[model samples]
Target: MLQGWGIWALGGVQRIGRAHIFLAHVLLGLPGLLLRLRLLVREMYVVGVLSMLLIAISGLFVGMVLALQGHNVLSEFDAEQSLGVLVAASLVRELGPVVTALLFSGRAGSALTAEIGLMKATEQLSGMEMMAVDPIKRVVAPRFFAGLLSMPLLAALFSMVGVLGGYFVGVGLLGVDEGAFWAQMQAKIDFEEDIINGIIKSLVFGLIVTWIAVFEGYDAVPTAEGVSRATTRSVVYSAFAVLGSDFVLTALMLRGE
Candidate 1:
């Protein structure tokens, strides 16, 4: 049992080292990414545009639920007027980036791992190597850059749509005072503090999710089962990383306050 534990520990450390080296390679390829602008745009469409519908729908329902629950809770204190502030703050600061990243990981991140893993299984990467074409630069970098670019934009959209959904439920359905809703939200929410912090969180989550996805794919054993396992690992690992990092980041941000 002790030997097994030691082997597992060593394997984990080695995997982490390989991931860091993979990240370095991806970063080193960034300069050449601009020359392959078309590839980046295509990946942006694949990961970003395709994922928007899921993000928007999830945001809408999440906002509605938040407003409903918040209304019920605040009404106990006779403070239903603060519903807008509650919804906006919750979505902007916490839910927006975190939920969107989780969804992105399940959706686009898995796709990335499977796609790249299959490429490796099919010997495409090996073919590129034989042709003196760097597959990391030609393939992985664009997808990585796309995830970084798409995540914050998607998070912003989720927050905006969620706020609107809250308005729809709070003001239209629950008879919340529209003036109080928008007014309190405007008054209480700080752009730099809430919004900027959310953006930063989304960017960090983007980096984590994309990095894990690409590395898993690149490291996958060249077989169908390996690709499937890699895809599963990408989602599972991304979730753990996002949630753990979120706690750390929230603590740091609160301290800064």
Candidate 2:
């Protein structure tokens, strides 16, 4: 049993090493993505623009829920007026990056994997390769960069909308002091420590999610069933990667502070 466990651990490490190598190749090809600016823009429109509505709605609702729940708890402690600080800190520090990443993994990341998988199934990628065109440069790289570029902005918007939602529920509905809420939030939330680190977290999550999406699609077996399976794996893997990385990043960032 101990030997079996050792072998399993070794296999996992080998897989991680191979994944790192794959990521290096993909990243090294990123300069070519700039040459395919038109493709990148199109991907941005599809992955970023189309995803905004869902992100906005989710952000707003999440904030409202947090405010509602936070109020109930804080009321018992006679600290309901601190609702803004609670909402802002929670959204900006943790929820914004993590939730936005999960949503992006489901929405844009899955879509990316599906589209690429379908292209592979249809032999589009192969045809490009046979024609002496590098599909990774022309196809995958643009989508990868588009996801990376969109993520921080999406997370920022989500945080902003969440703050508004919190205000609407806490101040407008619950009649907490609006001035105190905003003031406490401003006093507690630091620009560099909280906001910037959150953006960094989003950026990292975006890279991990999109990397899994594009790589899974690219490596999928060239069959309809394979495409379907790849798409599912992309979402599942991206979610796990995002959550796992979040814990590590949070620990490192907090230790730095």
Candidate 3:
């Protein structure tokens, strides 16, 4: 019993260590980030089409909530019509990328892990190696592109849907003046830079999530339990990486502005 417990602990530590090391390796390949591409359009379609529904639905609901909450709080200060600015700020800066990334991580990241793990288990990857095809370039490259492309599209979708939802609650539901809302938003916010920042963060998050999932699956052992463990780890890592990178990117973008 003691030996078994000791081995389990050591295995946990080693898995963690390897995961971190793998992340570091990917981080070091920043220069290759833009140029790495395979099945670019196909990947984009997968990322964009498959993930759009969730992003749209989530953004719609979140925007409504934001309008409601902002109305309640800002009405106290007689700044009720500033709802547009509030909605725009939350959607573009905080919620847009974060929510979309979380959704994508759940759907796309798990799919990537399972696909790669299955390939590994079936020795399809080995066959590719025997055929002198680089599995990383073939598999990872397309997926990385797909994740990256989908992120910006999803971020834009989130921003648009969130804004519309906020408008619905603020103008239609709350009976606030629509013009006043947009006016305040235009005057108070830097829409250009903030949108760019949000999109950039989303792209980074997508890349990180897919990379972690693919890496784990690629290295997964040929066992059902091992594949399951990798999938779980992919999700946990996806969430952590998305959130952590969001904070870092937000700070850096805001600091320069």
Output the number of the TM-score-best candidate: 1
With candidate 3 superimposed using the best TM-score fit, by how many Å does residue 108's alpha carbon deviate from the native? 1.0
List, residue by residue over 1-257, the lDDT tens digit for candidate 2: 99999999998788678767767777877778777688889999999999999999999999999999999999999998899999999999999999999999899999999999889889999999999988887788888899999999999999999999999999999999989999999998999999999999999999999999988888778898998898999999998999999999999999999
For candidate 3, which ten residues in a row score worst on lDDT? 29-38
Off by over 4 Å in 2: 1-17
TM-scores, one per candidate: 0.99, 0.94, 0.85
lDDT of 1 by residue, 39-141 (tens): 9999999999999999999999999999999999999999989999999999999999999999999999999999999999999999999999999998999
Q: Is candidate 1 or candidate 2 better by TM-score?
A: 1
Each model's number of backbone clashes? 0, 0, 0
Q: List CA RMSD, all candidates.
A: 0.7, 2.0, 3.6
Task: Estimate the overall C-alpha local distance difference test score of candidate 3.
Answer: 0.82
Show pairs that collide, candidate 3: none
TM-score ranking, best first: 1, 2, 3
What lDDT score belongs to each candidate, Candidate 1 first? 0.96, 0.92, 0.82
Model 1, C-alpha of 205: deviation from truth (Å): 0.2
**Model 3: residues with Cα > 4 Å off, grouped in runs:** 1-38
Worst 10 residues of 2 by lDDT: 15-24
> In candidate 3, how many clashes are counted?
0
